[model samples]
Structure formats: C-alpha cells, structure tokens
Target chain A: MSLFAVQLRREWLLLVQSSEEILNPLVFLFLAITLFALATGGGPDTLQAIAPAVIWVLVLLANLLSLEGLFRRDFEDGTLEQLLLKAEPAFLALTAKILVHWTFSGLAMTVLAAVAALILYLPVSSLGTLLISLLVGTPALSLIGAVGAALTVGLKRGGVLLALLVLPLYVPVLIFGAGAVLEQMAGIETRAQIYWLGVISMASLTLAPFAVQAALRVSLEQ
Target chain B: MSMSASLSVSQSLKAWWHKLGSPRWFYEISGPWQRLFGVLALVLLVTGTVWGLAFAPQDYQQGNSFRIMYVHVPTAIVSQSVYMLMGAAGLVLLVWRMKLADMVLSAAVPFGMSMTACALFTGAVWGKPTWGAWWVWDARTTSMLVLLFLYFGLYALRQAIPREETAGRACAVLALVGTVNIPIIKYSVNWWLTLHQPASFTLTGAPSMPPSMWVPLLINVLGIYCLFAANLIGRLKLTILERERNTQWVRALVREVSA
Candidate 1:
C-alpha cells in the first residue's frame, strides 16, 4: 500500500481505538447547542440569530480540544522520528496526518454541525451553505492546526499553548465560514464567502505542510 | 593614504555594507550603531511624548482624551508593522540561516508586546469616553487582543522548545504563518462593517485628518519608529552577547566596553 494510505489507515485505527477522542467533541457540540437553546429561552428566533457564531465557536473549541494529540502521541512513541527520517518527504507525511486529523475532527464536526443547525433552527435553505462551508473550511483548520501541534508536540501541557498559537490563525476561516451562512440567511449571494473560504483553504493547504514539516523537524531535533 | 587609496577605501566601505547580508558582519558593525541609535531613540521618545502630551491640540470631538491618541495610534501602528519586521526576520532565518535573523526575531517580541500593550491601554482609555464602556468586543479591539496573543504565542513557543536552533526554526515558521493576521487587523473594519473606523492615514491619498490633528501624529509616529529602532538595538546587543559569549571577539568587546 502507498505510505499515505497506510498512514491514513493506521491513524483511523488509532482514532477508533480511542473512541472518546471522537465522541467527546460531538458531545461538546451537542452540549453547546443545548446550552444555547436553554440559555436563550429556546426561542427559535434568538437561536437562529446567534446560531452561526455559536456553531462556529463550538467547532473551534472542539477542534482545539482535540489538537494536542495530533502530534503528541507520535512524538512520545518515537514514531515521529521514524517518519521524519523516512525517504518519503516530511511534507507528505505531514499532509497525511492532517488528512487523518480532518477526517476525524473535521468530518465529525460537519455531521454534528448539521444536527446542531437543525436544533438551532437554521433555515433549511442555509443547510447546504453550512455544510459546504464546513467541508471547505475544516480541513484548513486541521492543516493550520498541524503546524501548531508539530511546534508544541513534546512540550508539557501543550494543549493551552497549542490553542493560543492556533486559535487566532483560525479567525479567517471562522469569518468566512460563519459569514457564508449569514449571507445565505440574509438573502445575499453567498458565493463570494464560499469562494474566499475555498481560496483560503487552498492557500493554507499549499503552505501549511511546509510549516508543519519545519516545525516537526524542530520538534524531533530536540 | 593617496587619492586612489581614498577611492579604494570608499569602495571597501560599500563592499562592507553589501556584506551586511551576513549576520556576522551585521553583528560586528551594528554594535556602535546600536548604541548611537539607542541614545537617539531615548531622546526622541522623551521629546516626542512631552511635546505630544503637553502641546498637541485636543480634538474638537474628543478634547483632552484625544491626546491619548499620541501614544495609542503610534503604538498600534508599530505593533502591526513590527510583526511584519519579525516575519521578514523569520524569512531570513529560514531561507538563509542567519543567526542575526534569530536575534532580530527575539529582539522584536518585547517591543511588539509593549506596543500592543500601549495600544490596548490607550484603546481602553479612549473607549471609556467614546463608547461609554471600558472595553468593547468590536472588531478592531478584539483583533488587537488577538495580536497580543499571537506575540505571546511566539514567545511561549520559543521558550517551550529545548534547543536554540530548533526554537529559532519553530518560532520563525510560526511568525511567518501568523502574519496573515496583520492585514486582517488592518482591514477588519472594511471586511466586517465594523464599529472601528477605517484607517485615517493612507499612503497613496490624502489623510482623513486635518493638518492640526495629523502633524503631531506624524511626529509621534516617527518618534515611535525611532524608539523601536533603539529598543531593537539594545535587544540585539544583548542577544549577541548571550549567543557569542564563548567567542574571543565577544570577550574582547565585553572587556573593552566594561573598561
């Protein structure tokens, strides 16, 4: 099998073996939606008003909660060193890890976000925009978050530091992702927001692996 | 010592200037310039602050509170600009492996932090009167806070890494990657229809400010630039001393300076 495929399979197994990692973020997503429903009096109008931001913020926090393990396990078990030394380019390996990260966190967030959108009374028409935005934007999060994870891989209590490093970088993705849904809700053409989000994701995909590779080299060097 | 000799001397000076692309040459030559700029910066800062605070006119709308702009606007501008400077340093460090680039990155952080702090403080003070609140989560204010966090992240990442070269590379990558925020900070108002006003100053066109308002702002900005240069020099010197302590030249220079 190709290295990328093998890496992806291995990561899938690892994520499955740690089911809580996958389930916890979904729970957090559900709980956030629930809290917003309760706190805002379960009024559809109010929930709809704040739903885009609430959903985006929840996804952000969920991804952040999962990011610490992205590189920590490999660094701890010496697998990261092996990957670094492999003949295959480190950027490719970084890309594979990011793919796995997105598959687990980003894909799960997409599913849970759909459910959350329904609960929040997001318009039926806006659902397509929400899903498309998440599909494009979430991988960008994983890709950028990989750089943060690689940089903080072996540090003690890296979770908070990882959030500190990665969250601000997520703002553009948040702006566009949430903005797309808002635009759709407002009866404007949402194409520009999606196009910008796609552009950002493409730009980040092209550039972030190098940063991840550089950061991983530094992490392993130490 | 001859006329042709003088011409050769000027040529060599130009050659040396060209070689400043090397960190070692930069470290060697920047020592004296650092001290000179440091003194100049201190003078400019003191004079500018006193002139700005004591002499600049109150805004027609903002009154004495407008004087806070003397500190706030300049620091806010410098905070973003310094992030770009650090990113340039990061690019040099990554592409060329210049140790001075690492030093430049390190030198920039404290200055960046101070500038961000000054901006936040002045923003808060200005907000109290203008917005009727000490703080608001407006786009500009929120993004400036995020910028502060980015600076802290760079510093914290540097501390977390155990090896110097590793730290340098990691922080450099982080700096380059995080620089996307600078433009966002600059245009957040335009992007979101934000409460914060769009930029008052522009390069290609006339400024929004009347002459009375802009002249002192221009001076204050120049003064802050001078101060940033001075602080950078001091920080770079300390970085050189720390990194080069084992070297003979550093030891000799230390002895000479102490003497």
Candidate 2:
C-alpha cells in the first residue's frame, strides 16, 4: 500500500482505539441542541424558526471541541514533528490526520445535526437541506479549525485562545451553511448558498492544509 | 542603452532593499521621514477637521450629521488598508524571513486595531442620528465588528506565544489566514440587507459629494495615512531598539541620547 494510504489507516485505527474521539462531539451537539431548545422555551414555532441557525452554531462548537485535541496527542508524543519530517511525500500525513479528524468531528456532527434538527422541530422538508449543508460545510470547519489547532498545539493554555482564533474564521461557513437550510425552509432558491458553501469547503480544502503545515512547523519549532 | 539603464535601476533597487534590512540603516534614514510625516499628519488633520466640520456644505438630506464622514471614512479606509499592509508584511516574513517585516507586522496591529475601533465608534455615532439606532447589524457594521474580532485574535495569539520569533511567525500565519478570510467575510456579510450607504468615492467616477465636501475627506484620508505611517515608524523604531538592545549600535545610540 502507498504510504499515504498507510497513514490514513494508521490514523483511523488510532481514532477507533479511542472511540470517544468520534463520540464526544456527537454527544456535545445533541446536548447543546437540547439545551437550546430548553433555553428558548421549547416552543415548536420558535424552535422551527431558529432551528437551522441553532444547529449550525452547535455543530460549529462541537467541531471546535473536537479540534482542541486534533494534534495534541501526536504533538505531546513528538510524533507530529517526525510525521512532518518523514511522511514520504510532504503533507500526506498531515492531510491524513485532518481527514481522520473530519471523519471523527465533521462527519459525525453531520449525522448528529440531523437528529438535533429533528429535535428542534425542523420541518421535514428542510431535513435533507440541513444534512446536505452540514455534510458539505463541516469539513471546511474542520480544515480551518485544524489550522488553529496546529498554531496553538505548542501552547500550555490553548483552549479559549483556540476558540477566539477560529470562530471569526468560521463566520462565513456558518453564514452559508445555515443560510442554505434557512433558505430552503423559506421556499427560496438555496442553490447559491449551497454553491458558496461548496466553494468555501473547496477553498479551505486546498488552502488550509498549507496554513496548517506552516502553523505546525511554527508550533514544533518552539 | 535602455537595457543598461534598466539594469542599473534594478541594481540600485536591489541595493536599497538590502540597506533596509539593516535596523540601524532604517533607524537613521527614517528619522527625517518620520518627522516629515508627523508634521504633515498634524497640519493636514487640523485643516481637514476645520474645513469638514465648519465650512463644508451640509448634506441636502442628512444635514450636518453627514460631516461625521470626515472622521469615519478616513479611519475606516485606514483600518482596512493597515490589515492589508500587515498581511503583505506577513507574506514577506514567511517567505523571505525578513526581521524588519515582522517588526512592521507587530507595529501595525495595535494601530490598526485602534483605527478599526475608531471607525466602528465613529460609525455608531453617525448611525444614531441617521439610522435611529446606536448599532445595527448592517453588512458594513457587522463585518467591521468581525474585523475587530480578527484583530483581537491576532493580538491574543501574539500574547500567548512567549518566544518572540515564534510568536512573530505564528502571527504571520494567522495574519495570512485572516487575509484570505476577510473577503469571504465581506461577501457573506453583504448577503444581509444593507442600510449603510454605498461608498461616496469611486476611483472611476467623480466624488458623489461636491469637492467642497470630498476635498476635506481627501485631506483627512491623506492625513490619516501619514499619521499611520508615523505611528508605524515610531513603534517599529522602538521595537528595533528593544529587540536589538544587546547590540552595539543600540547601546551607542542609547548612550548618545543619554549624554
């Protein structure tokens, strides 16, 4: 097998061994959706109106929570530096790591977001739109969040700092991702919003890895 | 003959670039330029404020409140430009490992952040009489707030990293990332219903307002750019001294000043 494929397998096995890595953000998304429903009086009318935004925001936070540990383990074990150094072709290891991270965080949150949307009384008509938006948008969030993670991994106190750095970057993704679902609910054409979300995801997928690689070097150099 | 002349010009440009890399050379050369910018900033700012606030024609619609554009427009212009400047500096630092570039990046942030804050404040103040609210999540205002948050992130990231070089490079990465995201934020934010008026000045057209109004605005914009330059140079000088304090030139300069 190619080294890149091997790296992917290695990352998948590591994540599976610690299954909570995948479960944690899903659980967080579910609970946060419930909390939002509770805090806003659980009225179906209000929940239905605000459901897309609420779910999108919670999904963002869930991805953020999962991202805090994206490189923490490898960094702590000195494996990150080695991985960067010797991963056959450069960036494949980091790419594999981010791909695995998205699977655990972004992909899982997409599934959980559907459940969260239903719980918030989202219209059944809009369910597919919400799922599609999350599936397309959350990987961009993971990519962006990984840049923040790589930047902060060397710091002793990085949690709050990570959120502050990454959230502003998340604004566009949030806007388009949630806007798509909201537009579908309003019976407006959501093609533009979905296309923009895809554009953002594609842009991040291409660009963010370079940033992540540079940031990881900065952190490791320290 | 043309080729030889071009070669010589390029050779001089290369030499000048290397000279700028030396902190002491920059310190010495910028001394007179800083004074020049400081004086120009003060003179232009004072004249523009007087002209804009007192003598310019009142708006046919909004009356004297439109005069706030003198402060608001220049600051908003400078804040965004300063971010772009820092992003360019960040690129230089990351690609070329230029020490002075990083110093310029660090020096530009607080000034840029304050300019953003000033723009937002003046924007809010202007909004109250015009929009009937102290704040609105209009496209411009919301994006400016996001810009402020971006500045805060860079500021906090710099503070969190203890090592100076590491901090600079890390902030460079963050700054470049922010550069990429700014347009996305602007475009996304514009999807909201916009109440803030479209820009009054356009490069391809005459000013929307009379020269009596836009001239003062033009003056204020020039003044603010000078002020920003002066501020950056002043801060950069101090950063150079502090960073290079152990070096002989800095010590000699200190002794010369003290004596």
Candidate 3:
C-alpha cells in the first residue's frame, strides 16, 4: 500500500511538472473541435448529428496523442529498468502511472467534452449522458493505451505504431460511449450503454495492467 | 492392467511433450506430417473448390455470386481459428519458452493475415452482388478488418525489434492481448449488425442445407484447415532451419540433405 502511495506521488510529481505535455493535448482538443466546426460550416443539426461521434473520436484521439509518449521519458532515463528490478509487482507502479496519465488526458477530455458539446451546438439535454459516458469510458482507454505504450517503449519512434497497435481495441469503448450519446440524442434511455461502458472501464482497469506489466518487461529487456 | 496401461500412456505423453519442445526433435519428427498434410491439402482443396464452384446449384436468391461463400466462410473460420492457434502458441511460448511454439506463432501470422484479406475480399465481392455496395458496416467485415489490423500490428512489431528472443516475447504478450479482443469483436459486431440490419443473409436459409450446397462448403472448410496446417508446418520447418542454422543438428541435417 505504501509502495502504491509512493508510486502515485511520483507520478503526480511528473504529471504536474510536465505542463507542456498536459497543454498540448488540450490545445489539440480545442483545435480539432474548432476545425471540425469550421469544416461543417456550423450547421446546428449536422453538428448535433455528428457531435456524439465527433466528440468521442476527438477525445479518443487526444487521449491517444497524449499517451503516445507516456513512458518514453521513464524508459530513456533507466527509471523503468530500476523500477522493474524492484521486488514488488511492476503493475502497481504501472497502474499509478496510467492513472496519472488518464487524469491528464481522459479525465481532462471528459470535462472538455461538454464545452465541445456546446461548441458543436449539441442539445443541452444530451450533455449529461455525453459527460457520463466519457467519464466511464476513458479509463479503459488509458488502461489499454498504457499496454500499447509499454509494448512500444523500446521503439525509437512508436507514436504512429502505438496508435495502430491500440486503436482497434478502443472500438468497444467508442461504440458504447458514442452509442450512449446517440441514444440520449435519439430519446432512448441510455442506461444500458452507460452500464456497458462502466463494465469496460472496470474490466480494462483490472486486466490491462497485467498486459502492460509483461509488455514493459519485454521492452526493458530489449 | 488398466492402471499400468494408463501409467504408460501418461509417461509417453510427457515424453512427447518434452520432445516437441525441442526444435531439433520437432524438425526430425515433423517431416512426415509436413508432406502428408501438404498432399492432403492440395488434393482436398482442388476437389472442394472445383466442386463448390461448378457443381453446386445456383442459390435461388444470390445466383452464382453466392458461390463466394465457399471462399469467404472457410477463410473467415480459418482466420479466427488461426488467431486462436497463435494465441495458444503464444501461451506455450511464454509459459514453456519453447522455440517450436514461437516458431508456429510467428510463422502462422502472415497466413492468418492473408486469410483475413481473402475473407474481406470475398465478403466485399459477395456484398456487391447481394448487399448492393462494395462495403457495409456489418459487424463481421468490420471485425475482420480489425483482425487484419491486429495481425499487421503483431507482424510489424515482430519486425521492429532487433533480437529474435525479445521480438518473440513481445509478440507473445501482444498476441495474447489481441486474443482478448477477438471475442469482444465477435459479440460487438453481432450486436451491431443485429441492431443495424436485422436478418442478413445466411449460408442456407433453410433449416438444414441440402448436401449439394453444404457438402462442398464443408469440404472447402476442412480443406482450408488442412492447407493452413500444411502452410504452418512448412513455415515452422523453415523458421527452425534459419534459427537453428548454427546448431550441429541443423548442420548435420543440411549435410544429410546435400548428400
């Protein structure tokens, strides 16, 4: 438990200190939303029609953009090797790192999702479902994305490759998250989809760490 | 008497498992299987494809185009099975550190990939005649595309790493991770397809397909399985050769072949 706390604190320190890492994705979120709005000519219905898919996709993209390099810094400086050499399960440290990265990317994007909702002129009624779905879904993104990040950390340039590796796994999360928003938009009760998103969140949280742990071990050995 | 018989069976099984773990032992043993399955595949595939293509009666609904099912269904089933086989191989490689298991896992991916491509192409061609478009967002095709991507990622990853051992381990973890996605993709696509379009085409709409139709399909499916096995063993032998090139066993085998 104390080890987990220490790991959390260390991740917290790096996360808060890396302001550029945090800002870049937020800016990307903003730019992508704006560019999409401009491209669609700001038609309210079309924007609203596409808002669920658009917002969720951009959030996914932004989360991925942020996570692409989440572990490279640690790996380069040999922190990963030292951490792996320790007696404790490396998954605890990995979970903490992913949680911090999720905070910076997925959690932040959920909050920004509402503002983007407004920008896209989504009906105010659907905002609650949108936020809830992103909230439930994004942790899975981080957990799964961390596995991809860990696997690719040994590659000198793994950004594009990491995206390729992880994006397909994100489909269920996208389907449920965006599907919930679309449900709310269509006046259907979204309880089922939201529940499914939560299930994914819990599943990925518990399962992805093992994959991440093994992947990190392999990468470190390489 | 029964107890003694079971004891010997168990002991032999253990011996077989250990021998299978060694590349040298595996290479020595698998030659007969390679040739046998290769011949079986060649014979069965030719017969099945020809039978399915020319002999099967036209589908009352889809006409001659429904013939693509012969290719599509088999490739689809085999591709999924191939992924499962790779996952199982990944498990063995990771747990047992067996070189033979890793060889099977890596050697089998491209065949699995091409199977996915063939399924997708046949699906698309089948779609054009039936669904009226080159592509549709139906769950099966989408999931197959994703399957293709996972293979691409695994293949690319294996290529990216410099060392063979590290590449194998990384692919092991990745292949296992990808296995988790397969069932999820399967069910999600099922639900998605049902939600989007109810009652899509079936292999044979009738409760039981007549022998004229499904016999050929079954033959093709079994033939493809044999072909997949043949290709996998052949590739495994080649991989064993390349990886074991410096070993004395391999050197002797090479000299034996030359002689």
Candidate 4:
C-alpha cells in the first residue's frame, strides 16, 4: 500500500514537471470551444445548444492525447519491467497509476471545462452537474484507456491503434457523462445519468485492473 | 464394457483432445472437417437466402428493402459473435500458451472483417429505404463502424510484427482489450438514448417479430454460423501451411497437392 502511495507521488511529481502534458490538453479544450464559437457565429443561443456535446467531444479528444503515455513511457524505460517483477501485485500498481493519471489529466480537464462552460453560457444551474459528471466520469476514461495503453505498450506506432481500440469503449462513458450535463441544462432530472455514470466508473474500476495486469504480463514477457 | 473400461477409453480421448492443442495436430485433424463444413455451409447459405429473399413477407414498414435483413442481420450477428469467438480464442492462447489457439485467432480475422463490411454495406442499403438517409451516427451504426476499425487494428498488429509468437501474443492482448466494445455495441441503444432501435430478437425474452418474419431469420443466422466455421477452417489451414512450411508434414502435403 505504501508502495502504491510512493508510486502515486512519483507519478504526480512527473506530471507537475511535465507541464506541457498537463497544459496541452487544457489548451486544446479551450481552443476547440473557441473554434466552435467562431465557426457557429458566437451566438449565445447557438453556444448553449451545442455546449454539452462540444465539451464532451473536446474532453474525449483531450483524453486521447494523454493516453499514449499511460504505459508506453514505463514500458520503454524498464520501470514497468521492475514493477512486474515486484512482490506486490501488478494490478494494484496499475490502479494507482490510473488513479494518478485521472487526478492529473481528468481533473485538469474538469477545471478547464468550467471555464469553457462559462464561455459557452451554459446555465448556472447545470455547472454543478457538469463538474460532478466530469469528476466521476474521467477516472473511468483513464482506467479503460490504461487497458489500451498496456496492450499497445510494446507495439510500434501504436497511438492511432490505441485510439481505435479505446474510443469505442469510451461510448458508454461519453453517453452518460454528456447526458448528465445535457439533462441538467434542459431542466430535466439528471439523476439517471448520474447513476449510470457512477455505475460505469465503478464497473470499470473493478474490471480494468485485471485487464491491465493481463496486458502488462504479455507486454513484459515480450 | 464395464464402467472402468469405458472411463479409461474416454480419458484417452480427452488426452488426445489436449494433444490437439498443437497447431500441427489441429491442422491435420481439421482438414476433413473443413471440407465437410464447407459443403454444408454452401448448401445452407444458398437455401436460406433463397427462402428468405423469395418467400418471406415484405415488411408493412419497409417493403422489399427489408429484404436486406436476410444479409444484414446475419452479418451483423456473425460480426459481433466472431469477435467474441476470436477474443475467447485469444484469451486461451495468451493464458494457456496454445499455438493452435493462436492459429484460430489468425484464422478468425479475415472472416470477421468481411462480416463487418457486409453488415455495414447492407445496413447502408437498408437505411436508404427506412431512415431516408444513407447514414446516421446512430449508436448501433457508430459502434459497428468502431468494430470494423478494431478488426483492422488486429489485422495491422499482425502485419507489423515479425516474430510469429510475439505477434500472436500482442494481437491477442489487443483483441482481449477490444472485447469491451462488443457489449456496448450490443446494448448501446438500451444504455443510452440513441437513434438506433432496441434489439428485436432475444433468447429468453419475447421477440418483436412475428413467426413468419423470424423463422427465416433463424435459418439465415444458422447459415451464417456454418459459413463462418467453414471459412475459419480454411483460413486456419492456410495459416498453418504458411507458418509450418519447413515441417515434414507440410512438405509432404505440398508435394502431394502439386503432384
């Protein structure tokens, strides 16, 4: 458990030092929203109508940008090899890595989403749901993305392939996450969307660790 | 025979089954089975298609365009089922280190991709009449498109790596990871509000279709399964031949075929 904490701390420090990795996606999120505004004539009514989808699409793209590093770096540097050989289970180590990735990438996206929401003129009432949805939903993204990353860890030019593998799985998360914001904005009850989001996150959290462990073993064997 | 003697005979059969985990043994054994399935598949497919396309009732909603279901539903069903089948084979290969399982995974790819393409094309044809558009980003259609991409990725992974064993393991891992998409594709409409309709056919639940409509559909589904089995066996044989060209049995088979 202490090892996991140390690993988490190490990942955080790396994320902090690599400001571009953290900041680039945020930049993409804002730029995409800005482009949408420009393309659609910057009308408040139009922006509000498209805000939930645009935000979710941006989040998906931003997540794609950071997904490559989830396992590629560790696998390349021999760190993953040592971890595989460690006495503590690889799944725990992988879970901690995914958690750290979510904290840095997913949480950062959530913060940027707030600014984008304000710019897009989303109703003030929906802000809490949007934030909460991103908070609960992005970890699921990282966890599922970890499976793709681990599977493609040893392959050459695997970035695009990883996207192909992971994006389809991202549908459920995208559906429920975006639905929560959309429902809230539309003045409907978002309880069902929130429930589904929680369910997706919980399910991924439980299952993805085993998948990552299996992938990491195959990867390390090679 | 006494019970103990019968048990011994069955135990030996199980031992032989385990030995068939070797690619060479599987390749040799499946040769006759492949031919048998190939002929059976051809007969079933021809019969089912003729029956469904010619004899079945036109939909009150869709007219003759609904005839595309004969091709579309079977291909879609096989496309999804084949992925599950391939993923299961991949899991066995990865976990058990069975070379025969690797050959099965390889064999399953081209068939899966062809089925995916058939589904997509037939879907477009069906959509033109029903939806008044060639395409929509409906959940089912979108997920099927993604499934096609997954197949391409698996094929590409196989091509990129030089070592057969390493390639097999890598592709297996990708296949297993990609299995997450299968259920989402199956339940995408139920899980989220989408333009795609919910499932019409289920095992335990009541079907949306009447008996006249669905009986041919079942026949077509079985026909597709037979076709997949036949194609898979053919592909596995070719894969084994290519991979085992240096082995004595392959050499003998090549000489025999050429002669």
Error of 3 at A29 (Å): 1.4
- Where model 2 places Cα greater than 4 Å from the true spot, the runs are B1-8, B194-207
DockQ value of candidate 3: 0.73
Q: Provide the global lDDT of candidate 2 against the true structure.
A: 0.89
Q: Write the per-residue lDDT of candidate 4 for residues B64-127, one digit (tens) a residue.
A: 8777887888999899889888889888887778888898888898889999998998888777
RMSD to native, candidate 1:
4.5
Candidate 2 chain A: 10-residue stretch with minimal lDDT: A87-96
Ordered from best to worst TM-score, the candidate numbers read: 3, 2, 4, 1
Q: Residue A144 CA error for candidate 3 (Å)?
A: 0.7
Candidate 3, position B195, lDDT: 53
Residue A148 in candidate 2, Cα distance off native in Å: 0.6
Q: Give the worst 10-residue stretch by lDDT in candidate 3 chain B.
A: B195-204
- When just chain B is superposed on the true chain B, each candidate scores a TM-score of 0.82, 0.92, 0.94, 0.87
* DockQ metric for all predictions: 0.52, 0.85, 0.73, 0.51
Q: 1 or 2: which has the higher TM-score?
A: 2
In order, the Cα lDDT scores of the candidates are: 0.81, 0.89, 0.87, 0.81
TM-score of 3: 0.96
For residues A1-222, write the lDDT of model 2, one tens digit per residue: 387788899999999999887787788888887788889999999999999889899889988999988999999999888888987655767778899889888887787777787788999999999999998998899999999999999999999999999999999999888888887987888878788889999999888888999999999999
Candidate 1 C-alpha lDDT tens digits along A173-217: 888888888878888887877887788788888999988888887
Measured against the true structure, the TM-scores of the candidates, in listed sequence, are 0.87, 0.95, 0.96, 0.91
Candidate 4 global lDDT: 0.81
